[model samples]
Structures are given as structure tokens and as C-alpha cells.
Target chain A: MSWARPLVLGRLVRLAWLLPLAAVGLFTLISLAPIDPVQAYVGDRTALVGSDQRAAIAAAWGLDRPATERFGAWLGGVAQGDLGRSITYDAPVSEVIARRVPASLALIGTAFVTSFVVGTGLGIAAATARGGVGDRILRSLAVVLSASPGFWIAILLIAVFAIALGWLPSCCAAPPGLTLAEVGIGDRLRHLVLPVATLSVVGTAPLILHTRQRLVVFLDGPAAQHLRAHGLTERRIAFGAGLRHAVGPALNLHLAGAGELFGGSVLAETVFAWPGLGQATARAATGADAPLLMGIGLSTLLLVFCGNLAADIAARIADPRLRHPRP
Target chain B: MTLRARDVGLSFAHPGTHPDHAPTRALEGISFDVAPGEVLGIAGSSGAGKSLIAAALAGILPPAALLDGGITLNGTPPSPRDIALAPQRLDALDPLATLGRQIRRLGGRRTDPAALLARVGLTARVARAYPHSLSGGMARRALLATALAGGAAWVVVDEPTVGLDPEAADRVMALLRALAEEGRGLVVISHDLPRLARIATRVLVLQDGRAVETAPAAAFAGDGTGLATAFARRLWQAQIEDPAC
Candidate 1:
């Protein structure tokens, strides 16, 4: 606990640098894209807007300025808590993110929690059943699931559950005409099923494999042998000492996989047309919306940093030696 | 009644090989006896199958291992409650658990963890400490305390003095001697014969995977004339004559 302050400060310090790095990197990549911001803004009416009006639009959004100057000004604005405005949404970047945050959180959080709990349980079961038919079956299933792509899985689920049986909706977080408050819990959840299942299955595979691997090695390890020799039953040894040793690494692997989880979310969101940050990211990337994309990129970086920090804290809690090391 | 091993043999199926492959005989015709209030030392060079014998006695051998012969106490195979094995490595203690928790895990509902730690010469605070905070000697004593927690009649300790300084090694030897004096059967295994001789009531010498000699601890004293087997004599000679020893 005394280590908490320093750990938080250390992570914050890293974030201070990483935010700018991501912004600059995204800015450079956006600038390089073969896209005209004006063309994207005018959309289907590009020919009708005329060059003079196009020049006016570019000037209005500061796209006429040099990339370095724009980046410097954006960085300055970010330092003062302004994330600039989204050219695509015609709103502040922060406001746009705020509007979408809940939808994204709902989907991502549900998927993440589902994967974690189910995967951990499966891992413990497979490890305890080591070398048996159950172990082989679970391991084989995990390997196959891990090898499959998240988008493909999402598409397949949509095909069977949504298209053929017509048991669920195939696209969007809500029906096409619905607004945020108009959607019922059942409606939201019904819409959530396929995307959540896809993310959970993909996320769960690595955890099952990692947890099983660590626990198997632990159960066969010296500490466990010592416990086994001391009259503790196999059941106690596997769940007690074996689980204690395996959990820290499993939590670590799962949490540090935030990037992969987010990456999978993008794919999951795109396939299901879920209105989350992943969909926003796809929109921003496609339109080459510099400010909006920069805002999303910074948010993703912050999310990853937070995940890693949580991982460090979790590891310290799980293993006391990390929290209080003896010289 | 005594703990007895009559012609105990062990062979491991050569790993990752065809079923028809010949098994490797790691230990053959190993035999010994220890009664309550006795310290029987098993000694040999490194890889002398001393640990294999310990594993077999503790019934913790891997599935690939095939054991032949009986290890019984009072004319019956000892239950896990009747015997415990303390492995050689310090890593044998659960790194994540406090010493007290691990001790209580094995001690069951009837035994007190603090009392067990006290018996092993560790303070109550040591029980609260994790394994990583412990020194080499302290970890060894903690392992001893954990073994004692189960209230077993017999304790098999492997290389208790392997990584200790002479002072610490002496203290551990005294602890083992104390356990024996409390009427517990002790099977102490080590490569360090001279140190083991101080507390061992009888010594069983092994070479390559076979027992070379079994003699009273007194036979290891003086100039080795009392040792019956030539191999035991040379072992004693090597320990006494080597300056680095």
C-alpha cells in the first residue's frame, strides 16, 4: 500500500510522454494518407461545392496550415484540456468521445468480464484434469478458438444466429430508427449477444491456455510436491497452492492483453456494426478525420496505460514479495 | 514397530520413447529400517538415487516411475498422515502464502501453526513472514515446521544442510536430532556424510543407484578403520583427507 503513490506517479509520468508520442505519430500517419479533408467533408457534393468553397472549407478547419504548425497548436490545446474539434462530427473531439463512451464501455466491459471469468474457470478445470480426456478436449478447443480470427467468428455467429435462425439482430447496437434513451435493456442486450460472444470466445482462448500452462507446471512443481507429501489431498493441492501460484500470471497476461482486446473490439464492432469506439475508429480512419482520430488514439493509449498499471497493482497484491521486497 | 523397506527398487520408463524401450533403473535393492526415536541417514555422491529413494518413501514418484517393494510402518503402508517428506529445494515453500497459512494448510484443524513453528525454533513473527523474506536457514526451519505440522510419526528430510553455513548447518542438525529425541522416525538424506554423521544414528551409503553399506554412525569416526566396506572407507577417507572439504 505504501508503494501505491509512487507506482501511480510513475505511470502518470509515462502517460505524459506517451500521449504526445501517440498524437504526433497519428498526425504524421494521417497527413500521409491520400485523402483530401475537404473532399471528405463535402462528401457526395464535392463537384458542386466548387474549388473556391473547397478552399474556404479547408481554411475554416485549419487544414491549409502546415502539418507541423497544426500539430504544435493541437499539442498546445491538449495541454490546456482542449482536444480540438472533430471535422466529421462538427463537435469538440472530447464531446464526441464522451457521447460514444457509454456505448463502447457497455460492449467492451461486458465482453472483457465475460472472457475473464469463464476463461479462468475453464483454465483451472483443464489444469486439474491434466493429461485426461477433459484436459485434451479443453486444450484442443482453446487452441482452435485462439487460431480463428475474431471478425470471422463474429461473421459466422451473425450468419447462424442472426441470418439463418433469425433469432437475433444482425447489425447495429439498436434498431435503425432508435435513439439512445429509446432502447430498452432487453433490446440493448439482444443487440449485444453476438458481438459479446465473439469477443469473449477470442479473448478466452489465450487465458485458458496461459492459465492451464502455468497451473500445470505449478502442480507438478516442488512446492506442490511438498504439499502433496504432507498429506494434503490432491483436490486441496490443485485449488489451494496450485491456484494461488497460477492466478498472478493469469491476471497479468489477461490485463496486459488490453491492446489485443481493443484490436479485437474494432473487428467485432465492425462486423456487428456496434456503436462503440471501434466503430468510431473505423469511421475516423476512413474519413481521415485528424482531430477525431487523434482524440481516439490518445484515448486508446490512456486505456492501455491504465490496463498495464492495473496489472502492476494486481501483481503486487497477488504476490506480497513485489509489494515489499527485502534488500 | 519400525519403518521398513525390503529390497525397494525404482525404475523410470525412458521418457518420450516407445513403450518397448527399456526402463532406466534409477535405484535397485535399496533397503533400510528406522524406528521412532532413530535418525537414519542415507548418503552418497550427487545423482546417487538418494532423492529417488526419498521420493519413493514419500509416495510422490511421477507416473512414469515403477516402484517394486514395500515401504511400511508397523507392518502396514504408511498413510500420508503418518509420514511427510521435506524436499531439498528452498523453493518448496509456497511463495505466495504466508508461512503460517501454508503450515495451517498441512497442520489440519487439530494442530496449532504457532506451536509447530516454535517446535522448529522459529518465532511467531516468522510464521507471518513470506518465504522470500526468509534467509536460507530460516526457510529450512520453516520447511521443517511445515513437515512437523501434519503430526506425522516419520519425517523424510532431504539435504537439510545443503546451502547453509557451518553454524547454520549445525543448528539444523541439532533440530533434526531434537525431532528424533521427541520419538519421531527420521530419514535424513544428504551427500554431506560428515555433517550427517553428527546426528545420524545409522548411515546407509549408496553408490550409483545401489546401497554400498549400512553401518552404525560410529563406524564413520576416527581414521575409518571401523567402516566395514572398502567403499565406505574410501568415502570417509575422501571427506577426511580432502583439504577443501
Candidate 2:
């Protein structure tokens, strides 16, 4: 089959099935919950009063219908870029997401880039220095970072750097307050440090260890021996040939790690008081804000999908054999 | 240009001696030379140091082999680019790379792989195909193309036609002759004496890590009691008589 057809069709199939399934499952669970959506929104079950008042409120939000009908309506609204209204904020779900997404994107984007660059570089170094003191040091550091909880690390970092050293502001530091240009690059980066570092430290360990292990394995394979015999320099064989072969698996790990980053960032955001999706999701969950909760879930799903897609594209580029049958 | 291994002695040292597990003496006092434009075929039983001699000549013997002699190419130390060996196995080529690229790499030629493939009796279409995709004979030919592409003065070809059909073997033998005629020295290592006799100018018989006989191809055949017949007889006796006894 032609490449383009499979690529487009695969994505289309994922969107066609997965979105509806997620929406239906989420809507059903929200509907069946013991907490009343009206009470959850208004903070008073008694305000949803007489039979007429209850019917009007339910009708306005299509909650008066059967479960299946309500789910279908929600799915249809999603198709038209309407993610429904926030039961708590009384705003459009898309508007809330749009307002909040930039903060989360910026935070996650910085964290992702930092983790990949630092982690991959360290992994290569560790693999090259396998069985040496450098490898031992890196392995120990990776184990420690990987084992520590993101919240604990965040708190320790805040205590040491923010409270003790007074190197950065403790909490709720506005991006513009420390900048002359409304949002100076330095100010943004400084504000991003604690959260990004927390996420990177937590996320980087597995990546470093995975890349290092994969590199060592590739070096031991027959392909490496053949390359060595071809009169290629050892450096060329190791970094050029070996690294290229190991990238596919490393990239898959990277994508999976990126998905986990969203979940892990909740603690970091909560500790740092960073106004990102994880914090938003946590607050919405505590208050039983179903629409906001669903909004966060949908955005997280989209981020994961995009990350996996990027990894697939990278794999195809790195090894054309993935796209074409070996012949 | 000539390729020579002078009094080459290679031994593997063992920490403790056991009668059944003695240190292997792969090559011992081996001395031979391949003159320009000559095909020197070495025939030996397995563990007779045929491969060790080949590795010594190509300057690729393992560190554990422990050489106590000298190998030279045109009176100078062997450089990596000076020697090329068509390994015994056909899939010796990289599975990830195209046959043409491999040929270009081996040939050390800046020419297109299609041109190189043409020299190996393969069409230009074969250039993009990988080694795994080729037939046994085709893979051998591609390997030969790689070895010959480097334009090396000498090639240490180990069993060039091992698993090939008669036709493929003939083609490969013919290609080696053409390479020899182009003033390149060829070392054809194989047990198939008939095939070697067809191409070699001189034939050497290696037994127990020593050159037991060295003669011109015509002399070896004219003697009527050739190395080929002798080796065959030994193999038959080992397979038939020794097993029964």
C-alpha cells in the first residue's frame, strides 16, 4: 500500500473511534456519580428546587434526557468545537481550556525539551563510558532521581533554592513583575526553572538509562561488527551507525514518558502554584467540576496523541525500513 | 606488487595445559608469496590454519592469535585500505545498506554502484537491493564486486564460491581471473581444488598449519597424485573408515 494512505487512514481511524469512546465513557461516569451536577456547580443541592425548576435546569444543559441521548449530544457538541459549558465557572469549556492551555504548554514544552536534550546527551555519555566511573555516577544519579517522588523533589528544591538561598521567588510570581518587556525571556525562564527542573529531574532518569542501555545493545549487534569491518572509524560506527539504530526504541520511550509528564506535573504545579492544566485539573476534581475535568482529560489525550505521532514520524525518518519493506 | 607472509607463527597461550585442551597453534613457520597478477589457491582441512593464514595476510588476525612473524604488502606494512577479504559467509554485507553502496565502499571507488553491479554480472536494478534480498550466488558476486571495487593490489578471498551453483561458481571464478589479469594478486582459499586449479597460477596445500606442498597449477595436476586427490582421500577415510572403526 502507498505510505500516505496508511498514515492518513490510521490517524482518521484513531480519531473516529477513540474520541467517541472516551467521551461516552466519561459522560456515563459523570452522570452516574452520587454527587448532583447542579449541586456540584451551585454549591447547594436545595437551589435545584421544585419540579419545574429542576426540569428547566436539566433541559437547559440537556441533562433531562436519557443517558445515551445525553452522551450523543455531548459527542455532537464536541464535533462542533463545543466541549460544553463549565458547570463550576459557567464559561465555555473551550474558552477555559484556551485561556489555561498556554501556561501548561509553555511549562510542559520547556520541560520536555530540557529532559530530551539533557537526558539523551547524558545517556550517550554514560553508554560510551560503560563500566567506568562516569557510568557508575550517572547510573546512581538516574536511580535516585527516578525513585524520588516529583512532589518531594519540588518541595526540597523550593526549600533549598527559593526559601534558603533566596535565588528565586517562593510562590505566585507573575511573569511580568520581574520583566521590563511585559514578559522578558529571562523572567519567563527564571519562573519556569523550578517546575521545569522538577519535571525534567523526574522524567530524565528513565530516558537516560533507556538510551544508554539501547546504545550498548546496538553496539553489540552484528550490524556494528559489519560497520567496524568496513574501515569506518570507531567514533563514526558508534555515534553515527549505532545511535541511528537505537533511536527508534528511544523515541518510543520518549513519547510514553511525555504522556506521563502530564500526570506527574500535577504535584510540581501544586507545589509551585504554577497556573497550568495539572493544577487546574486538580482544583476542578476537588470541587467536582465535571466539565473542566473533562476538558483537562481531553487536552491531555490530545497531547499524548501528538507526542506519539511525533515519535512515529521520527522513527520513519530515522529508519526508512519502517516505512518501506526491506528488499 | 606482492603479498607475502614470511615465517608467520601464530599461537594461542593457555593458562593451564590439558591434554585435550592444549593451546592452538593456528599458524606455524608459514611462508608464501603472491606475485602480481597471480592466483594462489590454498587448500586445507578445517583447523589447518587456512583461515589464519588468510587473516595474517589481510592483517586482521585476532589479538589472541599472537603472531611471531611478519606480513607485508609491496615491502611496506599493510594498511587497512590495501587489503580486502570476501568473507566466507554471503550475508557478510550489511543488511541495512544497499548492495551498490557496499560495493562502492569495498571498491573504494567514487563510481556509482550501478556501474559496479554491472561488473559483477548484476543489472543496475540490483543496486538498491540489500544483501538479504540476493540469491546465494548473487550475494557472492556482490561481495566479489565489493572486494574488487576497492581496486586493491591484492584480495584475500575466503571461499568465494562456497554455496554457489555451478554456473555462479564459474562466473565468480571467471571474475577472479579477470581481476588477476588486471594485475591484481588474488588469494583464493577453498577446499574445492578443481575450482582453484581452474584459476590459480600456483597452488599451496596447508596441513597441520604448515605448507606441505607448493607447485604450479599445471605441475600439481600433471603429477597425477595431486593435493586435491590426497585431501579427498583423507576426508573419505575420516568420514568412512574412522567412524566405523
Residue B52, model 1: lDDT of: 91
DockQ per candidate, 2 decimals: 0.80, 0.26
Error of 1 at A135 (Å): 2.6
lDDT per residue, candidate 1, A1-327, as tens digits? 898899899889988888777777899999999988788778998668988998998899998999999999898898899999988788999999998888888888898899988888899999999999999999999999999988788889989999899999988889999976899999989999988999888679999998899899889889999988877788989888788677788888778878778878888888888888888888888788999999998898888888899889988988888986557
Query: For candidate 2, lDDT tens digit of each residue in B1-245?
Result: 67887888988867557757766787778778888899998876887888777667665555457888778887877786677777776656766567776666555457678877787788998888866678898888887777666666788888887878777788888988888898888899977666677899987778888777776776444333444456544633343333321
Q: Write the per-residue lDDT of candidate 2 for residues A272-291, one digit (tens) a residue.
A: 78877777777777655667
Off by over 4 Å in 2: A28-69, A143-145, A168-181, A325-327, B11-26, B43-65, B89-92, B99-111, B125-136, B148-150, B191-193, B203-224, B228-245
Over the true interface residues, superposed, what is the Cα RMSD of model 1? Answer: 1.0
The window of 10 residues in a row where model 1 chain A has the poorest summed lDDT is: A318-327
Interface RMSD of each: 1.0, 3.1
Top model by lDDT, which number? 1
C-alpha lDDT (0 to 100) for residue A104 of candidate 2: 81
lDDT of 1 by residue, B1-245 (tens): 79999999999888889989999999989889999999999988888899998888888899989999889888999887888888899999998999999888888666677888888899999878999999999999999999888788899999999889878988999999999999999999987788788899999999999999998999998888998888888888888787544
| Position A166, candidate 1: lDDT | 98
Error of 2 at A213 (Å): 4.0
User: What docking grade does candidate 1 earn?
Assistant: medium
